[model samples]
Target: MVTLLTGLCCALAMAPKWALPKILAAQDASTESLGQAPADDPRLAAVRRTMEPFGPIESIRVPGGDTTESLVVGHPGHRAELEVLARELPGATAAITELWGPDWAQSALVVIAATPSEFAALVRVGAEMPTEVAAASVADPFVRGNEPTGQRVVFSPDAGRRLSADGLGTLLRHELTHIAARAETADGAPQWMLEGFAEYAAHRGRGHRFAEIAPTVNAALRTGTLPEDLPPDTAFTGGSAVASYEQAWSASTFVAEKYDEHRLVELYRRLAAQRQDAASEDRVLREVLGIGRADFVADWRGWLSAQAV
Candidate 1:
């Protein structure tokens, strides 16, 4: 099995249901049916080819997105999951655009697997797909200056079983943000910034209270376990993963609150453009946020401390 993990949508998913504002829920009544993928739909080919063996494939057109197309796909057993993603598509796209702007393809493919084998095929992870991972965003390789191709969000077979409708909705937003920002993200970029930015985007404007969004960090802060530095890449995958995700999210949240959403995005663009050492990172932090690396950490720590109460 493939063991290499991809970027963008890897973390614990636990968020309460958020009532969609009326306008966002306008399409809810429309997803009652799903149709077979037409043989000529090129976009469906990406996942449909691999997913067909699991069962007969069914799909629904997402109501609102970029001029191109967006779809949610799955087999019969995954009808409910497919409908949930289809319903969430427009709102999730709007939320991502509200923050990520209109630079991306905006069009996407969301696939729900019926079994672990199907899940691994969709995500293409060589090793067994990790059970804890609920979804991932991937794209066919593209040049630095152009739009990405073959972009899709694949959900594990167990995602719907493990996550509630609203949970899947939050996860959809989380992964879509990754898809939206993939053009700006580079390999070897700092994991803290990458995951933190995604986390911030995921929970932004959802009316989630701080403690609810970051239970691990809140507990650590109240117990006097303040993070002195940003989480390292390894921290995203093991026993420390959940707390690291919370701390990372807090860092991005602090930047967005203390400065503004634009600068938080600007910081992500500059820092994630390529690999950086401490000195280079310090330079970019100062350039974007008008603070050195140490000061950035201090401010983030202070932000976390304030949220403890």
Candidate 2:
């Protein structure tokens, strides 16, 4: 049986709307051997060094078409979680590749933390990692036109306890989407495009109903409280986080519907390359989607209204 998992983003946290196109069936916990650890690869050794301080570690290698994609790592106590992530990694990568294309490294080091300290270390958050985040994608400082290095998705220790197999797959795809798109995504880019694009990728082609995915927005729509504009970056944190995510996803889905998936991606590329204010967003909207910011927001609100009933 599949269950919903609730892992909200702390800062860059992807709230719990993540679901996926592919899901692995229940498996023997021991059957997660996706591949053998390939020789003395430097990346693998580096990861081991980082994780070993927390405790003795174990891993499963996820093979790609020719080379391989990732290694799922965690403590023996969390073997079951590692196994599920290992099994889910391939399909998640495939989904990201399908959407973002085959340009990225297509590989990662997935770590399941043994404790909060371990989680903090893995994601390099110092101490006291944000408890709201279920999983997050991290990478070394990416240089323009260079493949990203040290890219990994670190899962909180409680991820396994909180997320089901299906949830694991969706969250994996969500974080992997961030890893895949990281290079194109500028730090100060609009939050609607950055997080919304990732949220859109996570749910695309997964047969999720609009209301099902954006229940918070649906609730607001029912009360004649449609969003006045795209969720501002400020909306992504603190009290309104869940609602903000729903609205962001809703705005992105509207783009996909009015234009097409390809244009939606194009829009993401255009808008995510820099910080956006009203005028800059208008320029990008006219360039990519051919609608100005006001029209885009108007159309999105209309789209949100249609989904309410």
Candidate 3:
């Protein structure tokens, strides 16, 4: 069986429900009929309280046509919050459905339940998560939307237990980046680039630049640990996986900074076009950047060494 692993919403008349009901009774009627007060629940209350300073809460909904009774929280920064959330969590389906202005959505969204106390809400997000993608274990393992529907975010149990804004934002960025590119490049793309792209996007939004870590990567290269070429499937054993990802992230950051964002997309597109993955990627890089692998590596090393120490 062909395994299709991506965060894009597969178009279907029905959105397969993503829930493992531990607390919610299976017999409870559909959300369309039983939409309850979000304020009653502690989680929803917390969400509401956090959002209260900005505006009132509004209804949250899922693609399944279920509406969540919520308070609409509208304020200046809320819109940016949603957009940032949307950008950072690209794997989830999200939309600023009601845009009052450039940065404002009519309501601050807390989907699946009227309140956070609903265990099923968390379960539902978990259920929608694409299990095929492997990421580090995080609290409330969630994803941001990647498709036109908006950001599709998944919040695992851990997200609620000890949620810190910084950590949540990082997680949001990582998973959402998954949502953004999940549909475009899954078929023949390299996993290292896949993750590297997401990692780069996540950190970049947070003002963290890979250039800051170039020295570390350069040191690895000097030790002969860095592969002359990007690591390939045959080389993807456990020994190389972690290091390969770091290198790929470094290379991706370098490309984005030295070249441009479109160039990164073009590089992936070219790589996907060729049947041979690594060779295809190299060809694309050489064609676009006009540098051979050896020269590119040497230049990259020198560039790393010259960065602001």
Candidate 4:
């Protein structure tokens, strides 16, 4: 979630507009089942054709601590790295379930493309994806109202090489939080709340202080350019994207510090569920937090100042 591709993935969750390419039927099932499935084994090829257009080189079932849930990894190579990720699944899932509850899907599918082009093909975001994005949690293409047919976290091939173990863990947890909350997530939900909440959950109990996690915002505050409001969606895609991310994370942190964590969750649900209209949004603000939008912004600004100092 630390790159520009995050916005594109978030947009996909709100409106699943892309179409997946259709796969052709396998000609012979018995023939495909002949031997140890090679990279291009007809059986693997057939399965890939049916499930994914890019045809991942290989996939394996990773067992989770809970018998009911599992993680599936599709990768072109770097089996070692995939194994490392597999080991981290239980911890990540535990962190998310601890806060969001256990009502989400029983399985997670992770795709690790061998190259950027392959990653783009899997996610289908095309030219809009930035090279810097390490990973994304995308809603299933077949999602219907209130029910996501499936969800997966897709990792750029470079992610395995680019990110350290801790960095990778944080990235996975962040994306997983998105998947857990995707069903309730609204397209029109305030970007700050959307991204901020995810960041907050991702960093929970990681012992990162506010100033350390949000140095950009701290710098901005020290320069006397106090951000008066939540960042617009444009900020997520613009040059100030990193700072925008920090601002959002700080805002969510502020909410949790001043109010209760459950209130933060309620705020997200109410705002995300309401129509994307000013009047309805304002009503939700007053009803849920007992404050108007202006007052909330002022309060957030005050919190930012205090944190920066």
Candidate 5:
């Protein structure tokens, strides 16, 4: 999930949010297996070295259910915050499991950056971290082929400062959903659907009203200019990026409501497995949803209008 850096000039505003895309330079398969390594292992020394410039690093192992394990790292001073997130991870993992099932890795890692620079450095997104981005999940794709290695969730310093506990919980669930679906996600998958599916899982049972969360799209629908297609990649990095996320979420929500959650997951698998483009997208729409792209758009627009504030 990419978020545009806020307060940037028009040219720099297009920088993408750092995330684990479907393709990345894979790390050595033997570098360090996740969840199995001890916090004091020599390999983790490198992680500590990388974070040393920021503050004293601390690590904790939080036991998950029988299927998953969790570890969290943060500055010594932020122990309270890290503990809070540690408590949230199990519930987030359970939620994703219920939505997509337990086909993902057996372990999860979370990092809490003490500063914005630390956040940027951990995610390897360069020196200039976007002010608006709250957190990112990253992993090496090449080490395990389609599977991820060294997967971890990194949070911007502002995240803990600004978000309520519940808000942070929702965000963690969103990134965890990405982690669970990473292997199945294709480098060429539709960004809209990817974000939409994650958002659907993140917001499920959160009790947020549609009008409260989708004011931008709702306003557009009231003006009768419904979006004609899924959100383009460009929509995720520059102006209206947040609105694009909402639109994507609304699209996935519509699917879950109109059909069923299982069908939505099936659509994701079908699209993720195929080579996606404008043409393949149309074919996939017909093949999976039994409708043409035009009809899908019409139906989605109608649903949007119905939910408009």
Candidate 6:
């Protein structure tokens, strides 16, 4: 079981959709050990010093089997710690061996190294975001530089390997929706709509969780705070965080249910293409849905309320 960490961007927070091609390298079957033991080298000492700031140092254990010494930086936020590690380790080839996160706690990132030199280098370089914008951020952050790491899938290891088949498809559908929506422009997008669209894409034609209307309606009924409408700038914080996602998913679903699928795609395409424009989303929404964002919000809220009762 992998421990997920905080600071790592989830679907709600990442600004762009990143995809990478998988790489595969030919291996020498007889070359059993992938790691070389460190020679009490001064370089390893230097690398450790660089990584000291992120969190508590529980232990820096060497990797078992053919793997090199592994650095397990405990309690550090995944994004910051990994970034720090990347900066300290400028290795020849570094691979993410495993990543796990608790539902409500920070995540753990495990990396594998083939040699002391490689391990030292990886820890040095892990702190920086990839130079390539395309490799920026994802659920999985492993990419083998410009070279292919391995290829069961077209995307980088970050994308293609993190989830089970169904989960991968769901995540892909959500990410692809961002591509369609162009929500990742300089102007940015409202979180509710952004996540809502992705959620709709992920669960399209499937029986609804909120649509059974049990969870949301019951919550709303209990709180007397069921939202009739949502604002655009919804974020992943506070009570609104979870509620907003539920509302957005349901709202987008309502739009899909009433409108054509191709229309939604066109709406996203138009919005994405005009990402630089300040008014692009509204313009696209008006043109595609024959309604403004405000009107659409009202309608969706009304639809949600009707479903609840």
Question: Which candidate leads the pack in TM-score?
Answer: 1
User: Which lDDT values do the candidates have, in the order given?
Assistant: 0.76, 0.74, 0.40, 0.64, 0.70, 0.38
TM-score of 4: 0.79
By lDDT, the better pick of 2 and 6 is 2
lDDT of 5 by residue, 156-190 (tens): 77566566566666678878887788777766577
Instruction: Output the worst ten-in-a-row residue range by lDDT, candidate 5.
Output: 6-15
Off by over 4 Å in 2: 1-33, 143-145
Cα TM-score per model: 0.90, 0.88, 0.48, 0.79, 0.84, 0.43
Q: What is the lDDT for 55 in model 6? A: 35
Worst 10 residues of 1 by lDDT: 17-26
Over 4 Å off, model 3? 1-151, 159-164, 209-228, 233-241, 272-275, 305-309
RMSD (Cα, Å) of model 5: 8.6
The runs of at least 3 residues in candidate 6 whose Cα sits more than 4 Å from the true structure, single-residue gaps closed, are 1-9, 12-172, 175-187, 211-218, 221-228, 274-282
In model 1, which runs have C-alpha deviations exceeding 4 angstroms?
Answer: 1-9, 14-37, 143-145
Tens-digit lDDT string for candidate 1 (51-121):
87888888887646536558888887777778778777888888888898998877678988888788777
**Cα error of candidate 1 at position 246, Å:** 0.8
lDDT of 2 by residue, 1-309 (tens): 000011122323333444322334347645334665654766667567678888887777778766865788788888777888887777778888888888887877888888888887777664657676778777776454545567778888877766666676666777887778777777677878777878788777776677767777887888998888888888776678778878888888888888988898999989877778999999999999888899889988888888884
Model 5, position 78: C-alpha lDDT score: 65
lDDT per residue as tens, model 3, 1-309: 011232221110101111111121123233343233345644355344434543454432222113322221223323323222322222222321111011212222332222332222332333433322222211122243422222234333223223333344454444445444433444546655665665565455455434332334545655554456655543333455445555666666777788877676566555543344545555766997877666766765555445433
- Best model number under lDDT: 1
